[model samples]
Target: MKEKLVVFSGAGMSAESGINTFRDSNGLWEKYDIYEIATPEAWNKNPELVTDFYNQRRKNILNVKVNQAHLEIAKMENLFEVTVITQNIDNLHERAGSSNVVHLHGNITLAKSSGPNPEKKYYPIKSWRLTKNDLCEDGYRLRPHVVWFGETVPMLMEAQNIIEQADYFLVIGTSLQVYPAAGLVHHAIKAKKKLILDPKVSEMQVPNDFLKIEMTATSGIIEALDLMR
Candidate 1:
């Protein structure tokens, strides 16, 4: 039987593909206020602004292609039972042919209802734009299917379960700063090997046992795959 490989990825994983990282220097946060664009209150205050922000992000995702890191991770499916648990909302992993992916935050490619039980249903946006006229089946406005600030991460438990069962746990491009999602790494106690791939790995506070590769995701993933072999 193939061993289970759980890869936990963050913003830096897609940075090479031209997607902006949130907390990094000159990132999106530097240009836009999080409270005004990424919070639930933001959507309530000005849904149009929130909608447009995500629409532009969606358009950017559609324009960019998956990088080498994404392709390498997908290729690992040939050697192990790989499950990608990503903090990113983009579909690059899927586009790169990674069959099993668990999105921790939420996917920007889809929209959900603004009404009660919003998570109960999701609507796919045919294009980059999702206007106020776009309403769900319940007659409520369709909002970006994202886990905004002050919102609960619905897939956290599922991610923990997947991590616990991993034989090989690989953390890529994440600074391990975000909560709940960052804490998921602790669940990989059973993993025989734990590795973190990032250029700033030395600066980050990861467990001593974790093998850190200080390189960008694109280059780091190649070395990571070599070690696995």
Candidate 2:
């Protein structure tokens, strides 16, 4: 049987593919404040701005292709049971042919309904644009399916289970600064090996069970695969 490898990837992994990472040097997502565009309060206060922000994001995704890093991870999937848990909202992983992925913060390519009732579910939109006319059967505003701040990460529990059972755990390109997702490292038991692949790795307080590969994901994951071989 193939060993199970769970990869937790983030924006840094995708940034090399010409996509912007979170909090770019500009410190803005198209001239909008992060708070104004990425928080639940902003979505509630200004639905148009939120929708517009994601609309632009969807356009950007259309322009970029998956880089070698994403491709290599997908290639490795055939040798192992590769489960990707990504904080990135982009579809680079899917484009690279990665079959299994869990988007923890939600997907930029997907649209959801903003109904007054939380139970009102969000559905994926195949159309490129989700305009004002696009409304659920209940007439609620359609918003990006992204899990903004203040909204619960709906898949945290499932992710924890993946992390726990993994024979190998890999984190790519993320600072691990964000909560809940950042805290996932703790789920890997002491015996399981954890590897973090990033060029700009700052202080990551792991229990000495995790190893940091201070290289970009493309090169780093290759090196990791060689070592595992």
Candidate 3:
């Protein structure tokens, strides 16, 4: 059997594909307050604003193309049982031909009901525009299927299981700052090898054996693929 390779990716991984990171210098978080547009409270306070925010995000991603980093990562399937665990809401990974992907954050192209049961079902939207009046089959208004702040990451357990099973654990473009998601690195403690790729990796804790590469996602992944070869 091929060795299991789990890729723990973050916003920076998608940034190479033109998807903006949430907390980068000119990132979406800078233009909008997280509490205003990315929280359960915000969705409740102003559902219209929340809908508009995600609509724009969906529109942005519709035009964005998957970058070299995503392509290279997908190619890893030839050597390993590759599973990409991403913090992004975009579909770039899927578009890049990656077979197994665990989305830690919710998907922007889908919508869930805001009724009494918000997490039970999700509806797919063809267009980038998910209007405020759009309702689910349950007669409740539709909301972006994103895992906003203050909400649990439904796929965390699945991700941990994948990480624990990894023979090789690769972290790309993540600052490893966010919680729950950030904590996933620990789950890979049993992995035989760990690799991290980021330009400005700071004082984050990791296994002493981790191979740290300081570069952008595309460049870093290129080098990583070479090393794997």
Candidate 4:
């Protein structure tokens, strides 16, 4: 029987592929600050700056390639029922051929109007420097299709369901500092196996079922896959 493997990934998984995360290796937001770029007030006060911040993020996503860890997780899908639950905003996992994926942080490559379901939910973005001039069909401001700090993650319940249904769980690269993503460990209902991969020790507030694998996401994912076989 094929076992269900649920993978939870974060910025570190895509870092090796040249994707800059919201934070740096030292845990600082790169190029922008949380206060100016992620808050609702920021968007309300200066919509252009918020859009511009996400614009650069979109461009940055285009420059990256899927890393070894992303490929390894993709390859594992062939052997087992793999479902990836990633906190990354980039499209690396999709590009790597992983069919079952969940993006918790939102995708950098999509755009949507800021108003209440004004008409469209997904728009393929061509550039990262979005200005006030960019308009949607409803003529509303197009915001980055990201789950900002103050907004609700619409997929959290769905992701929780995925985590609860997993037979095996693998958590990679996340610093586990943020809410919701950090809280997922609380849901592995029937999960009998757990492997957490990170170079630095994680502060995961997990129950006794999880085992931390101390290593980088690249080398650690490879190592975990080898052990699975």
Per-model tally of clashing residue pairs: 0, 0, 0, 1
When 3 and 4 are scored with TM-score, the better candidate is 3
Model 4 poorest ten-residue lDDT run: 19-28
Candidate 1 ranges with C-alpha deviation above 4 Å: none
Best by lDDT: 1
Error of 4 at 80 (Å): 1.0
Point to the candidate with the largest TM-score: 1
lDDT of 3 by residue, 166-195 (tens): 888889888787888998988886787788
In order of appearance, the predictions have TM-scores of 0.98, 0.91, 0.95, 0.92
- C-alpha lDDT values of all predictions: 0.93, 0.80, 0.87, 0.81
lDDT of 4 by residue, 1-229 (tens): 7889998999888878877555555543854578888877888888878887777777878877888898889999778899999898889999999999898878878888888783257787876666677778877878887888888888899999999999888888877788977899778888877878877655555557778788887878877776555
Residue 83 of model 4 has an lDDT of: 95
Off by over 4 Å in 2: 24-31, 116-121
Q: List RMSD in Å for every model shown.
A: 0.8, 2.1, 1.3, 2.0
Question: Model 4: how far is 108 from its true place, Å?
Answer: 0.8
Question: How do these models rank on TM-score, best leading?
Answer: 1, 3, 4, 2
Clashing pairs in 4: 55-128
Q: What's model 4's lDDT at 156?
A: 93
- The whole-model C-alpha lDDT of candidate 1 against the native structure comes to 0.93
